[model samples]
Target: MIFFEDTVSVVKVAVSLLLALASWLLIRFPAPFRHYLNPRPALTLWVSFIGLRVIPFIIVYLIMDFAPRSDTEFFYKKAIAAFAGKMVYRDFLSYHGPLFGYLISLPLYLWYNAKILIPFMAIVEFAIVWATWRYYQSSRPDALLMAVLYFLLPMPFVAMILSSEEDIWFWGVGLITLAYASRAQGSLWIGIIWGLSMIVIKSMIIVLLVPLFFLVDNKFKYVLGLAIVGIPSIVILYLLMGDAFLMPLQHSGYNMTPNIVSITRPFLSGVYNQISLTRLNTISLCITMALSSWAAIRYRHLGYRQIFPSLYVLTFGIFMLAQPSAPGFYLFMYMIVVLYEMVKIEDRSFNVQLILLNFLIVIEPIIWVIYVGMLNYDDWHTVFSSGVNTADYLIQVVEVGLLLALVWRTFVHLRSLDRAASQSFAASSQRTGSSPVS
Candidate 1:
């Protein structure tokens, strides 16, 4: 009884439905054959994941030289800036820190007339792979799967590699490196390495100390030791960079000015049409921060040391949202958190939190995409005409959602453990014929 157009709709819906079912199967099913799939005894699983990320970039670059329409202008301007040894200013161009522009354009400068971004892209991919691999030496299979999801379904690997944001390498590699260095080595050295991550990209690497403190028992000493090294280094970097350092901050503020200014403007007033449209983005930013804050509070009851990993993810996610460059940058950190929590099955309530968070991840972009894809949709005409496309927005929605879910789940699981301990203490007091200790 379905008409031709209805049949087309059914097919589109069916494909999406099948893909969702497959993802669920992959996540829910046991990896009984994981040992076989991951058969290299010599190399760790993290190493393999790194290879998975890097190899694709090399192959893809060979196949196509075309920069994505979204990133071509960024690539051109940055390349020009680095070679010319001058500042490139755009009131709206704040997706990445100045570090990214300098880093990406350096190779092209050295080559004098060659395409340097591609090789640099390859290096970035390699760094991300290596760091992400290190991130998972002891990481659970579920977490590993979440990482893979970040690479494949949620955000195309190409999108990450080509984007001017070099922090992907810092975050993807730096987080894993910090995890290994802190756990395997001692605090002073780990603190030093973490300081480097901050220098490379401040917001991306600041949270590494949180998980590091938890791994060690001497909480105050470890924190003090890290701060002893980290704080001064940060201040020194700010002093050294001066105007260069301020550039990233200026860029960030300019990007957010429209949204921030919109807050004072009325939503539905005829004069406020421009401001009202921007308000849609502000809601997501606030929600992302609120959820992260809630998770951080729930995670606090876990000993100061135990709270780092959660805090690291929560703080990073919040920073990304507040920075207001674009959805993709925020989603990148979200992907990391989601994967970290998905495989770490230490608590009963984690699954529930994960499912809800994932649903949110999946919903945010779909709304944006549908808005752009359909003429009948309220945002279709506006969003599409601008350089922004619906598909990428959908990707960001899903990626951030997954990562947020991971943090929420981790917080919930830790809270459940705390509750269980409290209950056990109460039961013991009851049996001992003593009043339950207040």
Candidate 2:
């Protein structure tokens, strides 16, 4: 039995590696296959979308029974309990927002079995693709690519859908919010409601509202819409749960720290130990906020089209690093935004970097498993052995490098737009023999 289990683990790892390799190759050689892969016809587009998104999800769902149990089981148990009149905070200690437990409980209402939950989650995945398509005004090919990326991208598939983390729902709703918020002219209520819904799902998502606020035309309506939903939700939760309502707030402050920090932990020795995790997290948060605020203020003058990419970088990019735990799925939304922007600007270099970064992230689990020798290794020393620690360190270095590259590219893109606008104004002034400003 032990040998058979070890063999199964090996097979799983090998399959995961091959999948990652295939995705890397496909991304690396997208052009040669674009003729066939890119959807030119409406029928082809829809077919490709279904094939890319639905089929893989179905396969995962079918095999969910055979897959190793994870936090999803714990969440499913808690969600079922919540449905049985158990309060999230009072009945059970939960680090997550109250709504997440309730949200996961939704699938249970439809079907009692946990396996059925996979298909429901797949539907949410489809919604994410739809949201991405709408948000970016994606071409058929682009939409198909988004679906493929979301489905096959190992981290998203493994950590989110397969593991059944509520982050997937958070991401789906967040994208929907972006879809509505990105519109130039629309009812602000929809965007505001979705935005608040995202926050209610996970309060950490509140950072995203900063960019959403700038995306829409009517700031007052947007803010009012948020207040409309947010104020009442808080009041009701407070009235019902009282002190338990503060649990999410309190939980947010606890510094779980990232695996990436372990890379330096050994080298710095006593020096690293001396610095408070709370202080480090606070400093990181402040830096992220300052940078995002500066960008928002500077780019507020641009048109909605131009402003969207900057807003993505400011909100999602900062949120990626600001969080205590560095889950790769956190980058899923940012990856979509970056890909959309990259396609718009035709920045192939940055696109390649993004794909490579994703591939690296997806493969980290392999190293993690090899170093730790199983998914549930509890000892800190075993989990963070020299090999795994070094691998994590390198992965984080690459992540940081890719992120900086993306930020630089965004800056360059914005600067080029500014230069073009200025040149157009200069030419118009020369033709008219007077400047409108003067």
Candidate 3:
């Protein structure tokens, strides 16, 4: 069922996938690797982690000089354009945040090449791994296990090694939110940081910011802080770009392939028919905020410090699920933050689906980019424009199903906390021969 006659391409895809599947099998049970992993020096671990992110792409694309996977790395071009004294929305058609154009491009100024972005992204990812370990330190996650799965997982691989995607900026705001909540610091710094994050990263931080307003204890202060920084920063941006400041924020209307919208596109019209970006963004935004607000209320009983896991996961997970713009790689951040929690779940069926979900999501982009439209993995425009064939469509159906299952599993796990609390209360009441609290 290969569309185009590319044996070499098939081999490349097959070998990479098979190797991932094998490594995933190892993830099912990491007990045997513990003796070896636990004894390793921390330096060795860090070096190995960095090596995994860089080496494969280095050999394939850097040394052998394969055709670039897609124009993902060229995102620095937005930054590059701004550095050369061009206005963002007027001088160039870019979907990135206004300041992000400058933020990512700063590396290119130092070196003046896209390869500079590779190292820049590497540093960003290294910080992410370090952040993952540091934030979960009290939970005492198995460092080696975290690194191994994080390494083997295809989501980050697709982002870092295959194509240099900047969607990890999703993690930037996400991690910032986590740190702010974990510390329970009532400082106005978060409002400032979040303000900076909106302009510096994608405006999707608005999604994270909404639930965060309720999840933290400092609601009034948070609101005051946000206004202090966010309001004027936005005003300045509007003044600078005019209505064009809304351009990047409105970018989500162009559906990224392999999202829920892709599944529905064929039915709405022909694959090429342009749907209303405004309508799609409005509907998805409403869905994202409604679900996130509900999740905030659900986790409100827990202290801010304790609400990070369920709150962040559900809020972001639903946002990713509901949005037409979020690519499968967006889930790259989800697995890193939630993998340890998924691993601890005792349900074998859920664990198996969790592993497959990670694997399928990596393939999600591949199927959309390579398989669906006859290997048109050349540019984001072409890739998103491509239509799904029957084979690829079937695969997306399964991916969506698995996503629903995992999100439900996570919700159930969170609900159990409330159940346990209620049970403990009832038991205490009974022991004291008192009326059980409703």
Candidate 4:
């Protein structure tokens, strides 16, 4: 296959799996792995993340002379346009959030080079790891180990360092919000930040916020957050961009692979070009709302922070599968949550599921690229465009299967929490000589 820059993407895939394999072995078999590096696990994880990111960065940027591809380059152009005084939705075009352009362009404003984004994302990755370790260290023995596994989850590593996606920041913001609410110090600004982040980051972020409304102990904060922050932000954007700010509402984009559309493409060839984004958007939105509402009602007794780890998997499952365009980079945003929850479960089956999911996701783009030989979609023949077509469909099946496993596990998790809450309430009632009203 003709890969980007003659082997950059292929080699990057290999490197991603290497990092994942190394992390998998170390985490799965801690005894022998720790025998050599048990002196200071903290420092070891830091070095591992930094070293893994920096080394490939050097080889790709300096040695191979590889430049920013697709998304990264596209972001830079949008930022450049914005810097030149063109309005985002009104003057030009963007499928992402309003702030994506300005945010991605910060490197250009300071360093005047796009490559700074690589190291910038590396630093963000480290900071997220640090935050996870700091939060879980008191209770969990291998908090940093979980962070390391997340860092090397293959799709995330490739997305951050190679593709330069900013989706990880979504989780960063989530961790911050959860940290505050968990401590009972949540302020209006938390809501504002979360509310604004939905516009600034991605609309799919609302999946996280919607459940928080049901589960968070501080309903006033989220209620006012969406109201005080969400309304004014919308009015201002509408004022600024007029009808253009409502681009997301229009659902003008087409379907991509690994979605309901692409999944059906192999058989329903006629529906390929005829696929309706508006219809898909409607379906996706319906699915998201039903899932979010069900989760909220099911877990109303629990605190948001208490269930957020599994919440990430549950909500993002809808985010990934229900959406018209499901980018695998979305996994990096909450892979750590899945890792931490799986650590609590300690089930070998979950371990297999996590590994297989990451492996399939990491190669998802490569498989599509190999099959179509390009990123742009031209016609209905795209699915059967190349010889790798059959293998691609099988890979897509496994990918979907692994994601569905997460859905099942999340249901099991929420059910267990519900039972625990019920039992605890029953015990307390017996001690107090009282009974539930029902």
The candidate maximizing lDDT is 4
Top candidate (TM-score): 4
TM-score of each: 0.57, 0.78, 0.84, 0.87
lDDT for 202 in candidate 2 is 63
Task: For candidate 2, write residues 134-191 as lDDT tens digits.
Answer: 6654444455555455455555555555555555455556555545655654436645
For residues 214-259, what per-residue lDDT tens digits would candidate 1 score against the true structure?
Answer: 4544556556656776677556646665444444443332232112
Please, what are the lDDT tens digits per residue for candidate 4 over residues 59-155? 7777877787757676677777767778878886676678777766676677666677777777877787778778787877767667767766777
What lDDT tens digits, residue by residue, belong to model 3 across residues 1-438? 452455545644564576467556766667776766666636645765656766765776679876544544557567678889898887777776667777777787687766666667767876777676666656755755675667666556656765666665665565676566555455355666776776676677787778777776777777887788778877887788788777876666556655476665555544325546667767787888888778777777765555556666776677677777776666765677677555562456765676666666765566566656433223344434535455566666677787777677677767876687779888999999998855
Winner of 1 and 4 under lDDT = 4
Task: List runs of model 4 lying over 4 Å from the truth.
Answer: 1-6, 33-41, 182-190, 217-221, 248-252, 267-275, 344-346, 373-386, 423-438
Q: How many clashing pairs per prediction, in order? A: 8, 0, 0, 0
Give me the overall lDDT of model 3.
0.66
Which is the winner by lDDT between candidate 1 and candidate 3?
Answer: 3
- Please give the distance, in angstroms, between residue 317's alpha carbon in candidate 3 and its true position after superposition: 2.2
| Model 3 RMSD in angstroms | 4.8
> What Cα-based lDDT does every candidate model obtain?
0.47, 0.58, 0.66, 0.71
- Best first by lDDT, ranked: 4, 3, 2, 1
Ranking by TM-score: 4, 3, 2, 1
Q: How many pairs of residues in model 1 come into backbone collision?
A: 8
Model 2 ranges off by over 4 Å: 1-13, 28-33, 37-64, 93-97, 137-150, 165-191, 210-221, 250-263, 267-272, 343-349, 365-385, 417-438
Give the range of the ten consecutive residues with the poorest summed lDDT in model 2.
254-263
